[model samples]
Target: MAEIVELSEADQQRKDLILRNLQESLGVDKLTKQLSTGKNIHVYWGTATTGKPHVGYMVPMQKIADFLNAGIKVTILFADVHAFLDNLKSTFEMLEYRVEYYQRVIKALLSSLDVPIEKLSFQLGSSYQLSEAYTQDVLKLCGHISQRDALRAGAEVVKQVDSPLLSGLLYPLLQAIDEQYLKADGQFGGVDQRKIFILAEEQLPKIKLGKRWHLMNPMVPGLTGGKMSSSEIDSKIDLLDKPNVVSMKIDNSVCVRGNPEENGVLQFFRFVVFPIISPRIIDIKGQSYSNYDEIVESFEEKESISAEALKEFLKAFLIGILTKVQDKCENEELRNIMNHAYSSPPELDTSELSEGFQTVLELKDMGGDRMKEIKGDCELITSAKLYQKLNTDEPLKVLWRVSAKGKVNLGHLGGLLQLKRLQALKCECSILISDIGGFLDNGKCPWNALEARAKYYEEALKQFMKAISLENVPIRHSRENQYERDYTLEMYKMASKVTKDASAIVEGNTLATHLCPLYHALDVHFADVDLLITGEEQRPFVILGQQLCQGIGLPSQAALLFPKIPGMNGERMSSSNTEQHLDPLDTVKQINKKIGSSFCEPKNVKDNVALDLARLIIFPLHEGKEVVIKRDEKYGGNVSFSDYAALEASFAEEIIHPSDLKPFVTEQINALLEPIRTALTPQSKMITAAFPKVAKKK
Candidate 1:
């Protein structure tokens, strides 16, 4: 049993403010003192998957630390089962790997932060069972609520797409039930999860369980905009990022000019780092800072609070935490062995391209002339300033080369000026050669030149789709209109087709080979599309795509879509060769170390144009039935929309006018997500077929 400690008046004030902010933002009430009465407060937060715990995980971790500092009993729950449900990208083996990874990472994070790990008891979600008594209590309570209200509340609890998986719908209720099972006095999460706690409060009393539940939520914003997310790479910094990586990410963060109220970096500072560094003071020095301004100032000044300085601070902070965690993780070797007791046999390799393929020019004189011409054109186009500008600020330099045999070699092409554009040749009739068909046939076109290109592209597309799906919108591109349109159409078509094929396979009890092409096509579309929309919007669609694929029993290649944190040479970090990379542990150490030294600067107007476009053109399409506020002559004004596009465009123009879409967009998103509340309702006996119930206790 954990003991509770008393807090000083100042500490209580800080906790009160934090709790108040959380309640206001999330629409939940503060916890009673009973929940906080334990001397050792144990609050656990973890992802469903073991992929690197992103910034979202930090929210709960920080809360635990705060509670610990306040002399409360703290218990950290890994929620491994929940991780498996949420992180569909992971294989069972990968899931195991992630569990270890998180255990180590989290421990490291805590240790680095100088948090007291001794008082902390880390437990996996699966370790605790839903005892028959607990289920009976839940069912008895379920009987008290009307089915309509149950459905409505249950829907709100999950707050995600309606899942056919019984567990998905029941999970929230189960989470609430955990409070009773653990005899926890309180629960904590981000503001987004306030509804769940509310539902828990309503149902627990109905079941005759103690009504003494306390809920605490933190306000954490995304790095680019909106909410901080584990899935959105740019929105939140990974604790494992290298210093350079963290610095680059911060430099690219979204920050509004004149009004610093909505800057992502500042939000991070206010919600995450500030509480750790200076909990009582909302403003530093004479500057009146909110969550956003703190980060902006930190990045703007390269001195103590500069991007480099902050990165170093975070890096050191994280490294210290992880080091301590690593020490604890090593003690679980026996548990690790037990977890692997029923491992599956290794998969046999069946790749025909193991030896790889040769480049078009390498394949004798099959299409040598056309290959040379195309290669020359590629080089010229790559060197053009316009083309380079179209690609990246770093210039459209070639980062890697694929040999005829599909062997990848790293190199850099100096500038776009060195390359010629084949499109230019297409404009002149004299330059049009019939032999150009040879280029296509011999794989001389850029599309076919590299074996890994499509793979990489597909990976990027999947990531893009996942990002868009979360926000429920199509991705927008500023350039290459035709390409973007074609890619979007292809993606939707692929999704529809794959969904149909997957249904057929599931119904017929057939294997899923037929669905592979659709999956591949969808993947390819995402990759090609991502190149065009990389920095424009938070790619929610990519995350959604991964979830969809996983739901449909397809492999989610999410690992491939993670943005490459460029190496010192401006090339993506690679582990393929000895000279190019360090081992995983070393890489983790380097990232942890480097992240501390880096700093994140706020994004300027010109840099965040894409995010602006997304807020304007894309976001509204998914607004569903949310009401929009309009100023009018009669009774002020309220305009609601079923047309997402019109609403999105209107909101973009109105709210994001000259670059301020944070408030409007977030408000609309909250409305759009309201329907998900119904999905969280507790299922009744009529729908009890959805879940496999545990037998009643003897």
Candidate 2:
């Protein structure tokens, strides 16, 4: 029995335009159904703004022209980002310039064929790729796929190397996301990107998006009769090439008789020349090719339609089409774009030097003994190998956390100073004020006052950052983003995996205290936090975060532990306990009074708040310099300790009295607080708003 499929006049035209010359098509029925319903299909063709457009690109250009002729809306996407993410072939710096070049050049290409530029629209990936909804989808996509799948999906398109960049895997995911985000009914790309297209087909539905059609054009051979590549100038002819140059390139191209399969000349006429030129006819060497098939037929036959005849015919046809393209590419704007887009990439310093010297040079400000103190209060680093943010200029995102249950204190201020130092080392740190967590901590942060308290903590930190010249550091209230689309989704995943373990470790029953670990862990994924700068007390959070790295599938965060800072009573500083620490916003008289009565035992230096003030507060603030203890001539007359160790040893052996140390450290501490004190004046209202005075009961 014979079966037939019927198509309306308009539907057949649209299908032919869309499917003609396509090497592969997915969801063809889905596309036909849309056409049957009188729906105008929107097909987007994206080109990564990486390299120049060549004669090989004409294959897709001819197809794009066909889409326009069929009355389909076409969006030419300048994928400005995919190139940067594709093994950094084009970096973020070159993205803007290349995008402009791609836009101009692609338009010129379509205009060269008179592809009806009116129906064609152009858009950039950056325009919508960074939106909140889109970013949530990206996060969702990350959770679905494994590292192996991501690697394989992009293996063909992303440049392969020994140690591939994470951005390379992200390249395909971003491209897959573009299919749904652009609202395209189908995507148009080369068959080379079939894996990524297939990835989109499977992953988009998981994210609640319908599977779209994929239109793939076959790979056309270059002038060398091999793959057309942007890197090899001789392999393809540039759109802007002069007639003589194009003729010369065409003349030298490989086109063997009866070998159209690998013949570049015959492929061009078959794919591009005949598709756009008209009448489906070409006269060559007393023979004619009314269609691409006739030329292929000639190639299969011996002693007919010689390679030179085909090359000569292709040369004239390309020359005619390139006249407008060359004219369009010669604009002043294009020249400027080319100059910037193709400029040399930044090079790394490669002068030969010893490894030890290189390490020292890389350390810069945080060199030698000072590096030990930078660990703050932590006894151990969880993942020592991942600690590369230090001493290097590579930018890494640092997740700096603080519980906004109480006012800012000197203990936290000292950590901020270290955070500022890391900022100098090129770490982009952001403060996550866990307001919602604080609210759940059995009224440590009252429900009614959560937002206010959060604002206060943020403002106080901002004032401190300004004093330390780190005013640009970002500060975010957790409650503001706790319920964010991706955050909440990942929070559930984190909650499922490790909530019991988090509950097992913590003594407290408060929701925030137990859930804090889970929230902190999930922040590594949602926030893309590369490093966690926290005191040793928060070790469990980092431990759980490492476990979640597998389930969430984002990069894990390395925790840098700072040794816990001692409070006035010689214990880990508590923001909730006013007696244990001095307020950063304290008055000079308050500061002096607090230090005068603080616990500083003579002949004992371990975890002593007073010595800590000297080591953490004074020395680091003074750029790791020596401290002088001011006193009378008989009382060791202005004794000096060259380092924190010397000072600690002297205090341990009773050489420096707590009495003398108190006044000297107090004076230095006040001096250190001066900038913050001054910056706090204008921002006083933030404190007033955040921590409003409570009414006392009679």
Candidate 3:
């Protein structure tokens, strides 16, 4: 008995399209059912106006053609505003130019790909994004969503910096709302947009909208065997890249033996080449692969094609495939569009370097320039490392002392890894925290030194204290007699007599839990260090340090304050919650467990353990290196990433799952810790002997 499964016409087409190179589709089956009844489908996809469209970029363009062939109305959103927010490297004035360039280039790409141009509609983000209704919707969504959620949604698309802009938060909300205003029945984009699409699907109904289908295509791997990125020229073959450039990029691509799963060139052939130029047999010299499977099987065999041979075939195949696009680019209208987009904005005079630093460039030949680049703070002394951002002029000798009684954690050493990369000077110190209690150093204290110094500036501490308002002082944790009994008030009232602004006095705990400021201030002079690199939370400390500087006859603006590193859990990395911190000495299994247990909301990238590790560890440790993750072919196989941003983008799109990510990160963690592990053995023994981890009785 033979059994047959019957499929409706629309179901067959739907299954065909979705099962083809499609990664995931939400509501596609329903959309297909509707199509079977002859209902029209509205689909929209957007492109950022950041860089040149490459072959990787063409993947979606070709997909859009497929949608039109299926009788779907396609809307191409040229996201000008979104592009600007994401690409901080581009100037604001260039938005219009970039969008126009994007539109024309997209049109040319479609035309070259044989997609129907007349039926496709194009819209710029500014057209609707600035409208009152759209603006109101965006604001409404912003009000409902947490900053964490917004940040997570945009993590893949947004330009991640040490200090992300407010625009980053706004970008995701605007995108989610754009789906509402566009009235798209279905949205098509690269897999990276899956999170944002999910965001739209969840939030749109609450605000005011019909739900839309989410259709996503697999992201094309870059020439470097990672997600294709516009920023990395060597990682991609741009649509505008010449034959020589394309050849060079492909030639340099990562092509391991018998690994088509991670091989960008092979994946490109399966996804782009076979789909576009199909029905024609692919013949390489006398040998020929009858179909995509044959080719893949050949690559997957025990003794498959060599990397060099694959590259040579790819180099030629890509040239033949891109010939039409290259020819289209020669057209006057196309050339003019790109030229105008790249035209320079109005130029302004740049600021000159302060004084003779520019003229003394040759001083770099001498150690004077080296001395000029050294900078440090109290943290630096404890970190036992010098960083590039610390010093830039005049050599300053610094002394680092570790108290025999102070508690030392391996976590501090982990933090030093970043500073080490910056090429800071390294020094070791032996000082005790108990010895430096409230600036009263040891049984042999530094207080007498401070008191002796304070004699010179009798009213300096008071003067400095009075200048800052107690109402908004930095100390947050309240204690008994916080207001009435404190150094700040005593000093403020005393110094009020000297200063002009004498608003009624107020008081709060000056150095409540610790004497870090006093130690920091004295450490500046004791160590002969000038700059104190700290966080904004330590601003009040810096102020206190400034007062100490006055008392010690040192410069007031000694601390260079930067933002703190955010924790994987979205809190400050230095939070009292020990779970938030990762020690350098943690075993690979321990690291994996901690990260796996940490928060990772699907498609949400904010405060993500994996993303944080990528930024803080993987990228820094493996800079200019190729990192790969192995997976089954069904799960997109072994994917490689060139940088943290590329990895973030992939994670954001849901192309890489947390399960896959945790193990990969575990591998990387152990790899990074290997050398450090070996080097810290002696130090660990000393640290453990001096300061064992013991519970403090409350």
Candidate 4:
């Protein structure tokens, strides 16, 4: 600032509008002092011609509107040289084409916003930055600053790499000198360029150029919940996207109601929409409104808004506003400029181009390269070999060991739900109730209680399969099967085939717990399982099964591992924690209350029991149908998701609130358990025999 100078009332108002909606401002006193001198303040906003413009460009465009409305002189600088220095994102041959593409599109966007072109002008960075005086200032400023400081300045704007090009280091240096050469009173940009703004303010004084007012707009996150990049197609929506394409991009984006400021859709309303359109908003009912705070209030209150409704509003606005831009691009010359400039952008941060299917769960190949997938959850651990095997013409023979001990909880139900999913893919599944094998260390089931407990487990399994619409799957008890005549000879053959004793962990007081893993492994042989389904914690038994089969010269079975279900307390669910899981026989009130009380942290997918229930149970059951999440009218109306991936993505991004998530999961779980709870009512005698005094007390 030159000095303290008071502005007139009219110029004061102009200063306010120029500084509105900025995340940070530097040297505001300079603008006020200059405004008081009865002269129009000059401000410049620059853009590098690296990628095609997107909806994110609206932030700066709206800021430019504010400046024009304030009656200030604003210059829109197309930074062609800066773009070329940014790892050569724009080649010299295409710079002219890209610059032309930028000029046509920006003018169209500003015209659509009704910003007056009377006081607005355009400049190319090469026009002034190429002059000898500017060249002398660049070298003079270079001698005053270190390489580390220059790297720190452009760290936010440049594409970082191990050994960066010299052009990247000079990017921020040239931007600093651009302020003096453009002859502007201030530089306006996104808050992302604050580092360069600070450098221009600090290093410019060494060359004797005074500091200018630097204004910044809040950064709007990209569509997929990160910094929007032109190289990443899914993260940003292009400005020239068709109306239908705009709807599709906004529809596929995941949003939740956790933080109103962090959501890309909500931030769009605050930074771009509100400033241009004022408080006017056409809500879901198509009614006119002067107030739009209802969206933020709903997100903060008991009833949160639906992600679908808000996205629809943004979709309509974007489509309508882009109509002018897209329509103007239909000109023959404009189309030629776009085709020449963007025909072949360098592959920066793009997904691999592949012919075969990408791995859905981030699986790796034998060469250790990460495989891409169209979609998957956090629990998918597979290989190309495994994928090939599963897609073969042979029908899969799957086996799962059902425990005939303790209360049957949702943990058991989750595994069976996966078994139900496999049946649709020609899997012939067999449930082996392991009565003679591993049992809970608890005293609920003893040797005398084996028959009644096994019977109880079978009834529970039948009801679970029935609830998932499964029928006629084979069920057998391991104790009964072990007594068959051929089993005696098979046990003798199995004992001689292993490399070492399976009793390595037979220490005092926990002998059964150590030997249980080997016992479960041998069950694979008895069941003739071609593919095994179990929790990933049971992987040790699968490893032992492979060794046993190798010693006996039988083919080893492939394993499909799933992470353990999270408990109500947000820890691993266990039989030891009695209240941590929902039992199949729980009453409707109990089921709802238990699931509602489960820990469901907002935007935390890994530790949320509600999300696990949705991903593992609710979604798998509703495979072909849409899962509708009921929302209050105060929030948006109900929203339906076709697949769990979309739902999980929304939840992870906070587009889905935990409060809404818990209730929906509770409702689905109660419905799934209703029949199971009813079928187990008549079998009270079996529970009494299996659990003794414990069953009555619970």
Candidate 5:
């Protein structure tokens, strides 16, 4: 048996630095005890061929290599099954190919680093014999937990009920069982998988296993922000990407000035590559030369650190990694075995020429015929690919066609139109009214058009209304108040207005009928409201909205209702309470209370209730426009007599009414306000005295 090797002073220093970097980057500690246990530590890593693996993979790959060098056996598992669960586009065959591809690449990467292949073993999860022990453990785990708890523990809440087959739910459990099968000391993944890892950890102890599973996660910055992903192309640099592509990607990567800590490229260097090289300074020097120009100068003078030189270095480094992987893939014997194993799946053999065989053959034939019959029933309407050229000279009349097979929905269509750079025309169809109008009239074009053939636009709208009503039915109403009825009536009124508008357009009697769906789609798609305030002529203009909400005492819940403009953070204003961390109504109340508390008290009568209200409500509502309220002390009342109505109408037309705040509106607003009301009792009392109260009936 191989004895664990002790590190030298220099090696120890490198190990410490690497572990520190990893711990900081991942916000987790390394398996220090595991490293010193004198046992072979193996790390197996593979990505399902969901397109190509990006730089996000580097974090785990580098960490695994670091652990391997620290005297542990590392087994890299290409989680082909997990990939199938995660990636919708990945087929079993494709997964097999991806596993092979990753195996080659991983091997090459190790070889280029001069890491020993003897200590590293790359294996496919699907190829590993399904351990009966693991299967029984999984069945036991399933039995121990309620279905709800199991679903919650598995992170299956976010997934739609029908989207995941039974296998998808079992995926996490299987992954947990993988630890038992592999006898892995630890597992590593992104922070998003924390729940899954925790489940595994919990389940392991119950199995009478004394060993605790270690989990290591690394921070991989995304293209826009937050966690990096293979899906977001700009967020990561692929190892296989060309030099120009890599340079452009890195150049465009988000960089923080005076804060090198979170810069994506710097983080990549610190976390992914720093621990591998013996001398840290040399690695730093290799990454960053004197300057781009100086590097160019050096390259011109001595062919060093030039763009070309760097490109060469990157290419060689990548190719060196890929070459070893490719060599492994070219291993005819292994390839043949994998091919045979995958092609001939170990399913029940019905080829014994028995009664069951005949029955299966007959069923297969019937199934084929039934599939053909179903295909015959379907009709192809249009063949317009998203982002492809349009033949219409009258501007693209993009309509929402609800085919069962169609991927693009009304929401998706709205998103697509927002990207088009064209003059949007009006529409004349009355049939296209609904939130579709809200999407269109918001300033882009009418992107929510019904297909000329589909007769379910109205029905779809009704269903949508029913869904919304059921989801957000009103409460907190006295029987006399008719609150629920009032809200329902208002919703119907809104729907009626939509129907009227759509009908008028459909009848071809209005200029609006010429409106294109593309423009409407853009309008709704980019409906986030941002406030632009111009200062003095010489001063730069200030852009504010959601950011200012917190400053003005807006509740966290309400503040979050306002969408974060792109580049604000990686996430949007999520309506999902779990994701947003607060209920929408609570958020609104928080904002209202915060603003009420922060309102500056002015000694002058001019800056009283009306003035303050204008500042607090009107200005913000008007997208930060300063407002003046006229009041007469003689009348003992205040009213806006200025062209404020017209200004507000225009503001509503330009901003408020067009903005899609509907999604963020909550039915429990009154309930949320109870706490705020209690907090502001004194203020409310004072304000009530200022405004005349209606006399009570006897």
Candidate 6:
């Protein structure tokens, strides 16, 4: 119910260019106001020269051309410094050459797309980034940015295969400052770069640089449907690909029928091909369409066009685009630049690791003996280098708590299963013997250990107690009584009292009786653990620890909370519930007997024990192999499922009866536990020693 405000012709055209293929816009009103006033707006977009320029690169480049047409001054940055920080596959020697290749190829692409090359300016990151002024700015900004803030900013673009690099943290800060240094009116990139752009818009004004508008293009999907990345060759079509290669890749693309969002082919045409090359002609079965819209409309309606026919049309269209672009890129001058760049190597900057801490270490490099040495360091690790090693570096050192609390619980055992999967995936996984029991020997009770650690985090603990006190109980809920009972105001009062009063630390009659949840929180900091794996039940305590630790300048550790596995009798599995639990050392026959007698409701997969075992244990243990169920000819023989979903669907729909499902699940369980049972044999003294002894009743 508001009056409409119209845009001027110049402003309208500017809006069209800015909005085309753009996912989101910030400061649009400001940008449009500037455009309407005929002020020259300068915009810059950049890319790392790590991967070969792919067709996906066309999205941003095409937009850059639109800016030039809109009478906006355009600058393109080749982010070589960012590429190095990102640890692109290229060696340091190849960065300069790679940048040259990017520039030349980008020029050819822009020219082919009808953008005015002469109107554009290009800048390499190192040109001004290495300057004294810029270096000072980067160092100055680092003081304001927390490692957690930096990490969150770069999360989308940075590679986080294992432990992330410190350079990754610096990457976003540099990118945010790039706009300030260039003195540009705006910056542009893919939607993934939005985080850094937002950070820049916030931080630039703080550093005395005016805020700039952000224009981001939608990420083009690979032929297989996810965002096209340069690292995944099969996922994307490289710019330099020959006509035959391009055609074949498109022909084999996974474009689901009638679904544009999931179909990479349709997305490419909508975002990339159509905007640049319109009035596209398509002839299918002797019928002619004037443009891409006609074909797409028919395809969506499921009338004339089919996926196969669409793929054929796509192959032809891509071949034409790639052929033209390839011809221009292969020009003698451009080829010479590429060849020169390829041959002339630059020195690799390996200094990022040498400075602070080596976060990434190849498990192979640190032989078994070295790993054993690390495992022996059960004492508190307070060194910054050691802290960084666990937090950010590769080959994540896992600490398996070997406490004398009792036999390792199912929750801890489940964590071990996850660790096994991580180890199999080439992650550094190791066990750490907890020194809590040993530390208690130095004092009478757990409070003594807590008091010793309390002096270091007293102020932070006080702040945490005050912070948590503000969270009022959900008194209105149906289960409010339970919540009030568990998290009482008096409990918080006690926590606050304990934070300040030394007398609150009490000596108990026994080591086990003296246990405090507060000690677990302290152990996290004392051990300098990066990631803490535990059951969901421990979430509140972990949150408490994280809140207190953050005040002490420590980042909250990432948590992987695996849900509690239900027992075979469809209840919480514990030693008290004998029918619900099965021993790890149970024989195959015993397991089969136990599972055959366990609960599995017909048609219901939710909280189903048999299915849970198949999901958590059997499937992960099999790792890509199918779980085959043998059946008689009359009942449908030899049904196999490649994944948990397929198996689950079959069971839910009653395609496989519970009578058949139970035995198959049991067999898989026995197969999974065979190796584990063997490792826990009497001869495996070290393995047996790792688990705490089960306490016996008097």
Candidate 4 backbone overlaps, count: 6
Candidate 2, 421-519: lDDT as tens digits = 777765677888877556445446665577888877777777677765665788876656666655654554444334333333545532334445656
How many steric overlaps are in each model, in order? 106, 9, 22, 6, 50, 5
Runs in model 2 lying further than 4 Å from the true structure: 1-7, 91-93, 257-259, 348-698
Candidate numbers, best lDDT first, in rank order: 2, 4, 6, 3, 1, 5
State the lDDT of candidate 6 residue by residue for 1-698, as single tens digits: 43344679768977786777688988787787777667878988988777788998888888887888777898999987777655334444577778988987888777777789999999998777665467545644654555456667888897653445445666788888898778788989999988898888877675576788998888988888788998888889887888788888888888776567888888877777676665565476677766556767777874676778777766776677667777877778767666665563344333323112233434443443333444321222222334455443366544333232222223234545655554543455443333342223222212223222222122222222222221211111111121132222112212222221121122332212112333444444444444555555555545544443432333444444556666777765553355557655566777788888877888888878888878776676567888788888899898998999998899899988888888888776665556545544443444244332445747
Q: lDDT winner among the candidates?
A: 2
Displacement of the residue 512 alpha carbon in candidate 1, Å: 31
Worst 10 residues of 1 by lDDT: 427-436
Q: Go through the candidates in order and give each one's C-alpha lDDT.
A: 0.41, 0.72, 0.56, 0.71, 0.38, 0.61
Clashing pairs in 2: 280-290, 375-562, 376-562, 376-563, 377-562, 377-563, 377-564, 378-562, 378-563
Top TM-score model: 2
Off by over 4 Å in 4: 1-4, 286-293, 345-698
Model 1 TM-score relative to the real fold: 0.40
RMSD of 6: 24.3
- For model 3, residues 177-216, the per-residue Cα lDDT tens digits are 7776777878888888787888888877866676778888
Better of 1 and 3 by lDDT: 3
Estimated TM-score for each candidate: 0.40, 0.58, 0.49, 0.48, 0.39, 0.49
lDDT of 1 by residue, 126-184 (tens): 55533335534443443344333333444533334432232333345556777766666
* lDDT (tens digit, per residue) of candidate 4 on 55-102: 888888988999998988899999887776655444556888999999
Q: List RMSD in Å for every model shown.
A: 28.9, 14.6, 26.4, 29.3, 24.3, 24.3
**Over 4 Å off in model 6, which ranges?**
1-7, 279-296, 331-698
